[model samples]
Target: MIAKGTPFVASYSGGKDSTLALWRAVRAGGKPLALLTMLDETGGRSRSHGILPAVLDAQAAALGLPRISGQASWGDYERVFVEQLGRARAMGAVAAVFGDIDLAAHRQWEEQVCAQASLAPVLPLWGEDRLALVREFVDAGFAARIVVIRRDLMADDYLGRVLDHALIERMLADGIDPCGEAGEFHTLVTGGPLFAKPLALADGDVRADGDYLSLDFGLAASI
Candidate 1:
């Protein structure tokens, strides 16, 4: 566990895992230096969840934290990620938080990149029961919606569904990991104890790309 009040950077993806990770870090008394997200070379969409920059900014605003993003291609992803880690370090971040659960390859990569950047890699959700983590996230008042799903593993009906106990049970009944750890799904967190305000999402058409379906959501007009 990170020392209380230690400055940390969150490896944010504007998704459920990152949201839960950040929330736990704050609750554990870490000072959040920034939310760092990786973007595609065009800086149009997040590499993982296809979330737009504007929506990410809105999330940062609600969290009262700065959003730091870098554009990178597949070939230079690690280099760009290390650079972001260095930037966060320069901002007084002593460690960086990750949300990977039981993925040895992911953990190895994070540790390697953090070592290169001289930042300690912290994984709060590592090695825990997936179902328990999902339950904790929802039960703790974090509100999230399914924003991406594997077409081969999930149906269109799951797109944009709010994450809750019932939803997790349904996914489990379908023989999927409740936490979506195996690339079965991705999510967009809209509200929770960590946010100062809830995001009003303007739903967009669902689009399919190869084996994945993505939800195109934008910030709705605030009344």
Candidate 2:
């Protein structure tokens, strides 16, 4: 049986890592109380990859999770992010889950924030083998698509492609991190083992802005 009253918040980015992390948390007998995402108010983008907020909401709904989001400018990231987390804490969340792998600076920042909020930081995929983890995500029935690609490291052709074993193999063969930890690519989870339903998105044009190539998906009719 899962632990009762152990409210936990999953830091969701609509990415494979966050999807896998939340799945692991659920499997570990923790109650997922909420999902948290940071929205960029200035550019109407997700902080990490510039995905549309509407798409993120659709993904959250598919996961059957309530989301608590905050909009902030680039300069206000740390403050607004922490404030949103504190709100989650006030709602009785005891811990926060992250899907980070082998990023010391990220881990340190997460620890600091959790400490401030008095919430335990859980890194479910930390220090795991990147290639193995990618394989696991695909094999475990998660449906992820490359929504953003860094132009210098990866071509724009990868945008909007499903992240499967074939994609993982190709990435590995190219000496790129299978998980795209080095900003080679970013993904959005449309369907996954943890989702109660699949997100319905209308395909939009891919736009290139400076160093990033982003695929836009707008909300169609919800399924």
- Best by the lDDT measure: 1
lDDT of 2: 0.85
**Candidate 2, 1-223: lDDT as tens digits:** 2254467898888899988988888887888888999988764778887788778878878788888888988788878888888988988898999999899999999999889888899998999899888899999999888888888898667789999988877877777787888888889888979778877787787788888988888877631
What is candidate 2's CA lDDT for residue 191? 90
After superposition, candidate 1 runs with Cα above 4 Å error:
none
Where model 2 places Cα greater than 4 Å from the true spot, the runs are: 1-5
TM-scores of all predicted structures: 0.98, 0.94
> Where is the poorest 10-residue window by lDDT in model 1?
214-223
Pairs that collide in candidate 1 are none
Error of 2 at 4 (Å): 7.7
